[model samples]
Target: MAAVTETLPGAPTTGTGEGERRGRDRFHRGALRWVLLVVSAIVALLMIAPFVIMLLNTFKSPDDYSAHGPLSWPHEFYTHGLKVFWDRVDFPVKLWNSIWTSGLVAIFGVALSLLSAFAIGIGRVRGRLWIVGVFLLANMLPQEVLIYPLFRMMQDIGLNNSGWSIVLIFTVIQAAFGTYLLSSVLGTFPRALLEAASLDGANRWQILWRVVFPVVRPTLSVLLIFFFIWTWNEFFIPLVMLTTNDTQTVPIALASLQGDRMLDVPTLNAGTLVSLIPTLIFFLFFQRTLTRGITAGAVK
Candidate 1:
């Protein structure tokens, strides 16, 4: 029996097999991470390259630009483009309008979306599913079809050609999609959390503020960033609704810089750069929230 014990079981001849499998798994994970990192870096550079070239072009004189490609570096940096931008454009007024309109749109849109999303997500009322479906349908519908009716409605309501009209239009248009996106996220939140909060005698408001808000914080950040960026870059809404210089958003004002026969590349690039700063600043400010929120939503 003692002599046969060594071969009695169908055990592996070597213990290295399990260790080898683990090593392979670790190698695969490491290789995948490095590949992703490299790909992300390359994509980021590609996205930013055009902007960098624009910046370099801004510093170059017209003579240099004409003689060389836009991608070529300037021999000497000059402030001529900056001067031209500041002198020609009414930067202060347009900048103010852009800031005010975009801020109002983002704030109000996010607020309305939160209420609507929470209703569909947590309430699960009799027609909750139907309501969500309606929102999704609206989201899928073309904006062009909605514009005419919206314009007539705004006219009847005495909101046409006003900043508030533009803000309201953008907020409402964005709310449908925002509500759907946020609700999808909120649905995955643990129901046990709400139940525990209720058992502790917390009302709906308390649950929202304490329990739900904490968990949904990341989703809110994403909504804020999305709405802000969309509203900031919005062009057509302002063009149609805000017909006057006083209420014109940045994009509309910038579009007016185009001439029938000639194009001013420096001024155009300068304005483009100016328009991007606020968005970059906004994203930087909330980057931590954005990253964490996206990760949280994705992980679950």
Candidate 2:
């Protein structure tokens, strides 16, 4: 009629088709996001369920627990179990011993690992791979296999049943793995920064502390946290070494309550909860540092 235009065959058309495709894509993406959220929530619930159950049972009386089960809530709020466990274990002393030993081990172990990794990685020592392999092998060795010899050695050194002995032993053990890990990270370190520092008349030690250390500090902080947690949770070694009540850590103190025949479930749970509080607090305080360090490492 009024000069109508005819489109050629296979000509592109823009309208509802593209809009519908985009809408479908957005809908699929939203559905997928909801699915992932549901999965993550389910996983989180599973992870937290045991802790919730433990908390519920911790305040339960032995009679109440026997009547109802571990999963059931307490009929009445009870403080007796917590007080009994706290006094029986000398909670303050055990907490102090753990803090002291774990703190020292973390500091000493991080220092040792930093020095060893620097020598092997930045120094580029001959046969560095073999040195790293030895560390790996040492780390792989079972604590049980070394426990007897370690015990004998500690006895000979007159450090048996001392918190210092546990500190020293765990420091060395933790450093071995730390060295192996830090070495790899340091090996791939940028040469440009090191060269720049060298050109600025920086010696090896100065360069290490001033330039390299700052960049790698994040990784070291991560190592410090790991060392602290590892030494904190050490049961077998501490159990064997710290035989005395005053010298023992939290785990040993809690474990001492377990008898050959009867077990006080509520008391044990209360102690367990108390023991976890310190570590949980430690982790919470350092949570930001841990996250920042990890993020820094990832960015680099």
Candidate 3:
């Protein structure tokens, strides 16, 4: 046999060029990731800066706020500003009124809408289209149009200038849109489930309580938070409905505090800060529900 020419038949060589190309690609990708991270961090900080400014300024004196930059640390932390704002704004009463009015509005609004949506959105309902169209039309009406009629009705019912008046208006305004929203959510639910419940001798009320209510809890939580925030911040309705300090909500009270002449900047800022507390607390409680609801609603 001819002596086999010892040729290394295959020394598998990693091509230097290909290896260099992959290394370059990985380097670029890593650099891009770092760039993105830095950009996101910067954006987050920018968004948080305004809140930091507000919180710090709440504790600052008028002179300190004016003398130093908004980002500056206060030389003295004082509750004087907060105390002044509380005394001037009658925060306790206003806050209590806001909480009461908002809670009633949310409760009535959600309950009414949930009932309406179920009645109309379920397959058993006849004339669903007409009812939905009517709701849509009502939703489209300008809130200003209802003002006169509502005002007259309130006067007739002895609800004028009372917390109940505000609560009633909020409920009315919220019901139409709330119905639309919940109907959309209900549309996403499987119809087979309803049929199954009906076949199992579950009454409409039982289906609503056991099957529908659980699935809609997240949506309800989101709506409650939104209604609370909107009612808390509502100025126009409260302005028209209520004329007395005793019944006024926080926004009205805050606006009244910042009258044309007596400009107490520190006190105004402090009250503004205080006004945000309830909303912040509300968000803290419902944020997870809100996020999940939005995600689930969108997908369904």
Candidate 4:
């Protein structure tokens, strides 16, 4: 009788409630997705708008550029501004100085950071936590606070007005973050393998270079890119340390174009457009290696 009642056509079906719930859930999810898409698109447009304006203004005639209506599109395009900017700026020397300095910062900064992190993370040294905490504290301090003292020290050592002074300064400042990051990486990997390397007649330095370094290469690549960008964009330290026309970096050279009044709108944009290209090219070239390193860390 119970079986016959359960099989009756008039009985309530459990699937009805489930189907209604699923319909509500699907509607909510669809609405949320659309909301996120709209927000993301708006943010992306805002970020890209400045660059678009810069590029458009680069081709505008100097007469068309006015303070009253700067954002308006030009009736005629001109190449004269770029030519003037290049002729005045000395692009080749500034570009070469920037390239080698940034490269040195990335390479030396990462190497120092790795060694510091290895000591703190792998060597199990006493007070490692305190040392790392100090580095973290130092990193948080503004560059402005440190620059004056650094300048004075450079003067004392007769290192002022030299390119090497700024390079060394950047390396030291950039290494702080690298040390913290690599330390985290060091803590995650197993130490037994490192121990085995040590026992197999490998010295501490050999184990670091031969064993631990290979494991952290991907993370190192990411750090290298970061150091390059940071050093390239730096202005204050370089301005203080590098005093001569012969030693100035790209930023200093561009800043030189600005006067007490009347900044060159079109030509300034053209110069900026020039300065940003190398950074763009660098990131594009190393994009894959960076992606893999970041993902590898996330997966682990």
Candidate 5:
């Protein structure tokens, strides 16, 4: 009979094959990470190139722009384009209207969405899933399809040609979205927290305002950023609703710079650049919240 052999405890079993496999895996991961980083950097540069060119054009003279090209760097930076566009567009009124309209949309729309989410997510009412399904359906419908009906409704309510008309339109459209995002966060909210609050004598509304709102403020900030940017850049709603120059938002005013009689590239570029600045600044401030807010609703 062959001699019996025993393997000892706490002994490292070495294998060249296993070691090679692990080394290969590490190599593959490192290569993939570097590849993705390079790809992302290329895409970022591509997106930034247009804005950089637009910025360069903002300072160049119209005569130089025509002689040279949009891609050409400015020989001398000047404020002529900025001043000309600002004066021509009646920017003060447009800026004011934009601030109020977008602000109203972000504030009121987010509030309504939060309350609705609280009822559906935290309240745990009957048919909550059905309610969520309806909201999802509404969100899926194209804004274009709803625009005509909304326009008619605004007309009937005598809000046509008013800034509130645009405000209301943005609120209605964005509220569905805010509800969707907030509900995802609230749905997963700890029931124990709500119960504890109730045990502490807090009412439902108080629980929502005190407990829920504080927890979901990150998501709320993300939603506010989204609403503000969309409203700021919104053209179709304002175009259909706002009749006169006085009621027009910054986007509409910037668009007015594009005339059929004469194409003022420098002024138009300057206006475009100006319109983008607020949004860029806003994102720079709130960008950290963006990643967290988007993922906070999802699982760990």
Candidate 6:
């Protein structure tokens, strides 16, 4: 009975071969993981290299930058570039204008988007798809194409050169994209939840606020952040609308420095870095919220 073992000609004789194959698979997997990790690290470094260079130049003196070029380290730590840019542009005023305009646009834009999406997606309105198509078309239209007409309209209403004009313009523009996105998202919403809310004696408004709003709040947060950041980076519209120095934003203020002559490179870099700080801080503060919102939407 003990001598009755049989083996096929090409088959493995024992569990050793099977175990070795598994070990080889694990080794290959580990090697692949390390390769991916190294590639990701390299990509990250490349992405941040420009920012690092900018930071270095921001603190360098004009003489230092001129002598050694952008890639070289600063000869000595210098603060004059920052002070020059801060004073030259009246940075605080520009910062405030940017904050005020972008903040208003984000809030109003999100509200407008929510209302439009609710009507199109949840209210079961006729021609809703066509309505969404229109919003999508609006989003695709270039800002340059609409700028002249918008400027004239603002001027006719005497809102030209006013911060409110910028606020109002961007709110509508941002809401167009938001509506397009939120409508699609709301289209896939659960009908059972809506029905249950209605059965619990909730009206349309109550159901929207209590059931739908809670579920879509994460998406709204994402839209809010996008709106804020987009409005902040807007250059062409703000440039056209805000003519005066007092009404100008950070971007305009920075642009105004580049007259016909060559300007101080380090000073310009300093201003650029300073302009990025507020938005960076805002993003970092809301990083967790943004991640959670994205994750929730993905799981749904």
Which one wins on lDDT? Answer: 2
Give the per-residue lDDT digits (tens) of candidate 6, residues 1-300: 577867889986788889999999999999999999999999999999999999999999988898999999998999898998899889999999999999999999999999889988898799988999999899889989999999999999999999999999999999999999999988988988889988999998898799889999999999899899999999999999998878999999889778787888898889999999999999999999999999999988
**lDDT of all predictions, in order shown?**
0.82, 0.93, 0.85, 0.87, 0.87, 0.92
For candidate 1, give the lDDT. Answer: 0.82
lDDT of 2 at 120: 92
The TM-score values for the models, in the order shown, are: 0.83, 0.96, 0.84, 0.90, 0.84, 0.94
TM-score of 5: 0.84
Between candidates 1 and 4, the one scoring higher on TM-score is 4
Roughly what TM-score does model 3 have, to 2 decimal places?
0.84
Number of the top TM-score candidate: 2
**Model 2 C-alpha lDDT per residue in residues 1-300, reported as the tens digit of each score:** 699888889998868898999999999999999999999999999999989988998999999999998999899998799999999989999999999999999999999999999999999999999999999999999999999999999999999999999998999999999999999988998899889989999999998899879989998999899899999999999999988889999999888889999888999999999999999999999999999999999998
Minimal lDDT window, size 10, model 6? 256-265
Show model 5 residue runs off by greater than 4 Å.
1-32, 291-300
lDDT of 1 by residue, 1-300 (tens): 456446447876776898999999999999999999999999999999998988888777777777886888887786677677665667777888888887888888888888888878987767878888998998888767777888898899999988888788889878888898878877777899889999999998898889888777777778878887888788876788888777887788679878999887766777777767877888899899889889987775
Residue 259 of model 5 has an lDDT of 77
Off by over 4 Å in 6: 1-13
Question: Where does model 2 exceed 4 Å of error?
Answer: 1-11
Instruction: TM-score winner between 2 and 4, please give it.
Output: 2
Tens-place lDDT per residue, model 5, 1-300, is 999977689987669789999999999999999999999999999999998999999999998899899988898887899999888888888888998999899998899899989988887889988888888898898768988999899989999899999888889779988887778778989999999999999998899889988888877877888998888988877888898988999999987888789988999989998888877887888788887877774433
10 residues in a row with least lDDT, candidate 3: 5-14
Which of the two, 1 or 4, has more lDDT? 4
Error of 5 at 58 (Å): 1.5
Show the colliding residue pairs in model 2: none
lDDT (Cα, tens digit) per residue for candidate 4, span 110-204: 99999999998998789978888988998999989999999999899888898778788889888998998788778766878987887899998
List, in order, the clash count of every candidate structure.
0, 0, 0, 0, 0, 0
